[model samples]
Target: MTITSVIDPAIIQAYRETHFCVEGDAPLTLRIGEKNETLSALHKASGATSSAFVTAWNPYSRRCDDETNADLQKKLIDELTTRSLCFVNGVGRHPASDWAEPSLLVLRISLEAAKELGNRYEQNAIVWCGADAVPELVLLR
Candidate 1:
């Protein structure tokens, strides 16, 4: 599916506002392929050092207090970490934000690894290739 079709416009807007011009002048290209094969190729191409920023939103929607929100965020982080796909970078929060339950979780990961992680949680997750001049929403099947 296209990024616009699957992602909430509010979330996209928040992202744009919070991360404006973050991608810099680095160029990026999206590639779709089997997960393992893609990872191997990426590793070979970048000497096992290529990595990108990735973000994932909370799967549930509930207006919780700050404590509850923190707990939920931790759970999401743990889930993602256990998969060895990425590590928590930080959270994206905005006043009256309507996307992601509380805030979106950020992590640094390789493009192929992000793709693999997105595939595992395709129903409620969107991953981005965030290391380029223009971050691309990765479509995982």
Candidate 2:
């Protein structure tokens, strides 16, 4: 399936307006793959210069318990950081009306790193490029 097919139109529009539309650059391509392989590929492709904004969805907010949710949230953040992704910012709940409970966690890393990370985690990897009119999703697996 194509990236357009899987992602919602509203999301594409929001991302375009907030990310791509404002930034004038090449449109990013989203690629999916297994964890280790994806990281390896990203490292090889980036050659040390390319960087991207990485975002992850934290669904624990929907759960009933605050403590458990907090723990999970910390775990997610720690894991991502451990992998070398730097924390960027967090979008408040419901940044996109169409999206559900999960709040978004944004991080910055190499564009190649984001592509590989997207493959490793579900609903967390997004590639934004300035060249495209909208965000495009590609699954490498």
| TM-score between candidate 1 and the true structure | 0.41
Lowest lDDT 10-residue stretch of candidate 2: 19-28
How many clashes does each candidate structure show, in the order listed? 0, 5
What pairs collide in candidate 2? 25-131, 26-131, 27-131, 28-129, 32-140
TM-score of each: 0.41, 0.41
List model 2 lDDT by residue over 1-141, tens digit each: 335345456544444433211111222222222122332334344442233444334331123355655565566567776876544333322333544232222333545656665554444335432222123333323
**lDDT value for candidate 2?**
0.39
TM-score of model 2 (CA atoms): 0.41
Please give the range of 10 consecutive residues that has the lowest summed lDDT in model 1.
Answer: 20-29
Q: Write the per-residue lDDT of candidate 1 for residues 1-141, one digit (tens) a residue.
A: 335445566545554444311121232222322133333344345444444433333432224566755675566567766865433243333445543333332344556665665454332334353333234434332
